[model samples]
Target: MSSATGPEEPDFPAATAARLDGLGLLDTAVTTCRACPRLVAWREEAARVRRRAYRDWDYWARPVPGFGPPDAPLALVGLAPAAHGANRTGRMFTGDPAGDVLYAALHAVGLASRPTSVHRGDGLELHGVRITAPVHCAPPENRPTPAERDTCRPWLARELTLLQPALRAVVVLGGFGWQALLPVLRDAGWELPRPQPVFGHGAEVTLRHTEPGRELHLLGCYHPSRRNTFTGRLTPAMLRAVLARGAGLAGVPCRWRPGTPDT
Candidate 1:
């Protein structure tokens, strides 16, 4: 099922893209990602080395991608997968400490099912939130090359377009994802704030498009990586605050209660 080709010209018709109000576009995008072969091969190799970590677990053979309600008003954009996390579990923000921090925050903010993320078969799901990484593949040392990031940018663009109806705000998880988003916004002719918005927990801005001033909210936060979480650089409360702020910008009231679906 592995194909060594780049993303095809998206057959996403305007009408089809328009109809994706509540589709599972994240799952589809993950299953269809064909960005870079180097990352793909590295992910596969990581899987082999980490087989003991997932001995009784199911691993996604291809690049692990994002998953959640496609038409959700809030979209969580994370950095690339960790070699042992999404790369092994085949689900964004799963199978790692970072996933734990993120899932816990989403759960607290009325987006996810629970505070803990497990294997692919764990049955947990996002109700009104979608999770995606700037780079699809887990880069070495968790850092993606510039070319790889550029190649992956179009995928995020198509995702945003397809999720128009419910896409209210984009929560960027790290500096890399935030920087990657700039080019996309520029391509869409959206105006950026002066000096650029700095990355911090709960820092957000609304971007205006020229034609009729249509807008999308942009928010920033530190990455929910193991390094960040374990070092206390990011906490569950901090992450929750970021989501709550983004929810406010989107005009989506977060009924942040355990197990309460946001949809």
Candidate 2:
């Protein structure tokens, strides 16, 4: 469960462990992954250079793992880590504006313990929800190429499989995450529609379970990036609505409202 201590070449041990190990072991392996050459170089470079504001800080500078309870019923899929965000803080959607919007909405809907996530040890907790990404390493300019996405797919696929027992709904953030997640879900034995469901804010699709007891739902939401939030393309109310819907689909009650007191 230790972080990568130095720059290393992309290796297969981590990937193998992700498929064979349990949640805790898988996450530890994920942090040490160096599967993509470009991603490995970029994430390490960013850490070494350091941002002006965070010059005094030490960056995690490794692949970021999914964060939250192992048996979470609700899951969230984000595109990738922000260069100075998760790539620095070692936690998904932390230390960034995008996280600010997302965690706040989750908190308002009674999913997250706090509305703000500054770092890993900030005491923020997610109730029945886990946050993950297609690409663990932060790519340059906040974008991972198609090859990189495909290379990183196994980790997510394994993660979903491990979560299948209790996972009922997944909220994918942005079109990238939506596209990236669908195939993984299908590969994990969920029966996706032939035409495939399109991605859009508030878009929802229910896939039949391979085991035939209950279905799994896929929910979409616009990424809570600063671009969308600052431009009015996405509002707190909008994000909260989508999350509330997902919670309901998962059979989880969301008692917190727009003006409800924080838990």
Candidate 3:
């Protein structure tokens, strides 16, 4: 609950994220971040200039917080919040089409309590899995500049550090998250390969942590964006399989359903 400018006022995100001791405090600080002016404006503008379908709903225009348990064994990393989705729900990936598919896949892999995430208070839950993003705010055109990404990375790094004790696996969605997360992993104690790993759907890489006998399984999967899903690049089964692998590596049990994908 502490920060450079005290608990009530958080200055730089990197400084703030570096000092925060727990995920709850980190989430609170993330929501109050206005460090990125462009993102702050865009998120608020989307809230004020409402989408017709969501006109009656109050939008959570601030930076969205990562969702799920504090002691998760597996973590799912995403690029950023969809402008109309997480930007409106206050929780990462909630109220979005991608979330619908992502949560469903998690449910199939026994990582989520439900197949849908409609809002922050939808009563849905995750089991041994935490979902987060590189950027907390919704970026314009769904693209965050490299500078913005860098500015936001301390949060992710800090989150991963907090989860490191229990974390055994990480599933990164899309190339952006893959690229953003590598440096964080290296800085957090995992040894990066000689050549940086290239991202691809279903790509899997095992990393050795500085601590003896500590290992991490990193998996890549296509983002469940409409383009990927509609083009069959990332199907229900494809997404489910990668999630299952990530969870399996964490030694978390999966309650298999009739057609759950296995990696």
Candidate 4:
């Protein structure tokens, strides 16, 4: 994950270690994360500051891990852990207002089976979508430094490989995610001369990767962060439209009959 989308040395080994189940890999990664000391400190501080809200809540005191159905084909790349969101819940896109809207949209589109994402314990699942972040640790002000992104990418690379053999399209949430994903595409020898056009809401750019010569459809969207939604920077329909386009690009059929609600 290069900061400014510059080509970097490929860190993904020709092959990764034996792939483990999704949950098992997530668990191990969380335990071994030491890429950024600042993020770890910030996450701990956020938890302590909001300790009252989580007095009875079991705070997962480690880098939040991504979670989804084990065999999902689509990977959702979010920016980073929000201070009170994944940083507190120890799961990507969980325990936050943003997740409420995201999970609902997923359910509407028939990708997620659950309507609410209360916490990691809630039995929410995705049919084809798996979520991960550019950085595992929660950074100060929710903004990760370039050093942090570069340092932590090994985890992301590993997660991608583990989820692979099934990975198809990846949806990057914002510019940061798009930047992080660029090196990944480059490593696979899929670098475009002109950087892929970046715009919020489902902009589909074809990614060229060799070895298997798969065309990975890259979709972009505004992150479901409180700063964007609470201030009305992004509308619910706008977000849904992006997801809908992504579903179409991924060849997921729409089942919203005239008389039926999206759910």
Candidate 5:
């Protein structure tokens, strides 16, 4: 399969992602990937040299995987693991301020079993929702390059492919995640809106799958990152509203109601 110069790019990640059949298998593949040299080195280094507050902690130091049921009807798209967050706790959106805000909102709306996501095996549960990211590793300054996003996209594409049967609503956090996920959705047989919908908080769009009459609703929300939440730009109320809307669209039960306290 190789000429003297080899192919333009080795698509091992994409090829392997396509062969995965289940979320468990996908997790295995994602956590083991070293497809991006820069990411591999960065994630490992962060884990090796942890922050002072977590010096006593052992870091996962590898590519993190999506969390929640394979049959979830709603999915939350994030950017990637925070160095001291998922990288430290081995769970997406865990062990960080971002996780704190997100889990609290999910709990307020009855989408999560607990208000906190401390670590894996903490008895926390998600109802009808799975949370994933475009990239899995911790990038420097919490920003991954374009090349890294593209290299890691196969995992997200495969996840969408596997979840499409049960998935009804997607809640994307931040513009970067929105940008990353549209192509994956398109690849999973959904026709995106012409001109491509731009990302914004409170933005909503519907995508139609190739099968006639099949539809998936998408809602955009600000990333529950510290920058957004700390600045009060993305309040708990704002988060709960978008989450509740997504849950309602996905047919997931919730206790929250519009115009009531956000909880």
Candidate 6:
């Protein structure tokens, strides 16, 4: 019953800030992005149609911003938001099956305050971790075309640039994210290895920072989507192992102790 508008380009800040204000400004701008016409249409339609189960819920219907502490040492990148998941809940990986596996593993590894992320204001907290995506909007069929991904890249680039000072490691959820993120990392002053590392479960690559005395570690993990989880391509143990390894490389303590049983 509601009418949706076409996509509008975002107005980036004239200059990037070095502290939290910069991140805050960029996040606000991310939520307002409407650069991809197809994505804007799809996201608005999904919100307007309203899933029968969530008929009473109001959809965010905007670009989903990255979620986590500004100074997080570990950054987790995913492909994009789910139409009925983040699009409905306004938070990355919330109200979805993939989030169920992800938050559980994060909790088990002690990076998350809780084992679940049901909604945006559910008191869930991420310690030394921030979850984001290459594309901010929910796309039809969960796939954003190459043009859409490229159009949405500047937001991720700015976020990483702002986070570089504190970021020591990154965990890419799937091949899409791994590929999308490498260029951003390179532009942010990381010296990526030649031939570029391929994405695989538990794959690790270390890169030297352009800034002296700093380095970054990149870890690849199978996305916690139903396709992978249902097929056993990614197990709880496998996900936890990658998270623990990433934390170690980032020089952060894993809350989940060794031999801790999975929830």
**Please, what are the lDDT tens digits per residue for candidate 6 over residues 36-126?**
8899999999999988999988898898999999999999999999999999999999988999999999999999999999888889999
lDDT of 5 by residue, 160-180 (tens): 878868999999999999999
lDDT of 2 by residue, 1-263 (tens): 22342224333533364556578877887887777889888988988999899898899999999998888899999999999999999999998999999998898898988888988887888999999999999999988999889877878888888886899899999999999998888877789897999999989898996776879989999999999999999998889988988988887779755555545
Off by over 4 Å in 5: 1-10
TM-score of every candidate: 0.83, 0.92, 0.94, 0.83, 0.94, 0.92
lDDT of every model, 2 decimals: 0.72, 0.86, 0.88, 0.70, 0.89, 0.86
At residue 140, candidate 3 shows an lDDT of 97
Q: What would you estimate as the lDDT of candidate 6?
A: 0.86
User: How far is 211's C-alpha from truth in model 1 (Å)?
Assistant: 2.2
For 148-234, candidate 4 gives per-residue lDDT tens digits of 887767567667767666776788888899889777667655655575566556677887666656777788888887788888877
Each model's backbone clash number: 0, 1, 0, 0, 0, 0
Model 3 scores worst on lDDT over the 10 consecutive residues at: 1-10
* Model 2, runs deviating above 4 Å: 1-18, 257-263
Candidate 6 ranges beyond 4 A from true positions = 1-7, 10-21
Worst 10 residues of 1 by lDDT: 9-18
Better of 3 and 5 by lDDT: 5
Candidate 4 residues lying further than 4 Å off, grouped into runs, are 1-23, 253-263
Q: Candidate 5 has which clashing residue pairs, if any?
A: none
Tens digits of per-residue lDDT, candidate 3, 113-187, equal 888888899899899999999998999999999988988898899999888689999999999999999999998
- In candidate 4, how many Å is residue 34 off? 2.4
